[model samples]
Target: MTMPTSLCPYRMQVHHIKQETPDVWTLSLFCHDAWPYEAGQHALVSIRNSADTLRAYTISSTPGVSPFITLTVRRINGGAGSQWLTREVKRGDYLWLSAPQGDFTCAAHPAGRYLLLAAGCGVTPIMSMRRWLAKYSPMTDVEVIYCTRSPQDVIFADEWRAFPVTLFAEEGAAQGFIPGRITREHLACIPHLKDRTVMACGPAPWMEFVEEQVKSLGVTRFWKEKFFTPSAAPATSGLKISTLQPVREFYAPVGATLLEAMESNKVAVNAACRAGVCGCCKTKVASGDYTVSSTATLTEQEIADGYVLACSCHPKSDLVLA
Candidate 1:
């Protein structure tokens, strides 16, 4: 499907905001001209801050629901964006948003059975896909294996239990639930994993671990969706950053984010959502090597093209940004 224009016309108003966890809040938005987003797609939501700075978030709600989109935000200590969202944002507040955008989605495969693996808030996008399938492709059998630290950390606990689901809690469960992380043994317990197409979304380590475990099972069509980028270090000196030139090079700090480092060097990169979820600030790497943060938004082709999100990427070594 074609994406919406750069300047989104839809205006969203916060209908309700509720605390789901000690650090996470569910913000529901009411929008005009219902936004068009496919399953697993994310919208770039921007909220006005005290100094008029805009903070961006990803739309967690499925687009099938008219006029409403939900966003789940996890509070990060010492984060200006998190602090503003939790402390200053109020119900009925209006916010600006870009058209929904994201490439992490379920490809049309005629596979009869499927596996959905998710961790923490990573469940948001996968939930969208699940809802879509439930809406349009009811016969597509699905099995959800969700992992979290404990029952309290489960984001969509009640809703998931109502479906064909397996819950894995690390801290321990009261029975009918698996304890600890998703290990190879847990995967082995699932029937027909080899015949099913698996879609995984979570932290990088989680994705890597599951991908590795499932590889030996002869599952060739495993797809991964994550919000975290791979780790990267600062860029070296004597480099330039811009979109005009097809060839570019720059320096980035180990701890300093790619956006922060690039902006510090006066590079013009668009980053509506500083968080890794939004794909803005994504650029082609062209050549050289680098790493991503907790959230990764690179496609297989983009990865081949050396593309990277300047917002979440840090330079692991001196590299070029095209």
Candidate 2:
């Protein structure tokens, strides 16, 4: 069956909850009907209570492996959605979720060799791709490097042992694992780094480091997914945005994302995965000078043609969006 539309949210029952770590839990959700999803795509999950909270989570389950989909969530100290999923939700609980959406997937860009780097909970999407590759593309050579605080904090550690995996622990070291943060020296050890496709996911800092390292190696094909919205620097100028569909205009303060600015002014815009990894908030720019922090979901031509991701874009000057 086809996936549900973004404008429509589907209800899924929690089939089971598995605790991978003290702070991380995996929730298996069963839909009333079949829903197809690719590995590495994420879904926007919402908790319908007094306060409606929505957040996007990467799917960790491989397609066709089971009748249900899975989301692995890590509890953040003050994060409402993460805390709800980890502490409040349970089996038989129902959640409203959007269809699978994101561009970070092996199916989108196939390669002969892949080096997957993940830190903390960022391993979710990479693990999905790994499972899919094992079942569908056995001939492909894949290597995974997962970084966490310690061995006790690693998610799905036992399952990852079956593959070519390397664990990097910062606080402590263990046998068959590296100690300390990932560095350029570590990336230099990989053979023919430029010839392999490098996909890294995790916090913005970790992904930025990985991106710089990959660029230094002259890697042509590199993909990255950040779970959190990028922190934008203070803007020097304000923005004037004009929308066409509803025919509205508004003034956005400097350093504010277009999505945030529009939402604050009560402008309706469907957005999911505000990190810019999902293309849900893509809009045509009628005219504007803007700076995008991340372009993982956009093509080079699209940027040239005045297309921007509203979630991660900061206005450099006055803007008009179509």
TM-score of each: 0.72, 0.76
Q: Write the per-residue lDDT of candidate 1 for residues 25-79, one digit (tens) a residue.
A: 8888887665667777665544442223344555667656424688777776655
lDDT of each: 0.68, 0.81
User: Which stretches in model 2 have alpha-carbon errors above 4 Å?
Assistant: 1-8, 49-52, 229-271, 275-288, 292-310, 317-322
Tens-digit lDDT track for model 2 on 1-322?
2224443367788999999998899999998866789999888886443223467889999997645799999987766678899999989988877778888999998999999999999999999999899999999988889999888888888788778898899986889779989998888888778888998899866898899888888888999887663233333336777788888777778657787777656676656678776676787787878888777779999988888888889988888887
Question: Model 1 off-target regions past 4 Å?
Answer: 1-9, 49-58, 65-67, 107-111, 229-317, 320-322
lDDT of model 1 at position 125: 76
Best by TM-score: 2
Alpha-carbon RMSD of each model? 7.3, 6.4
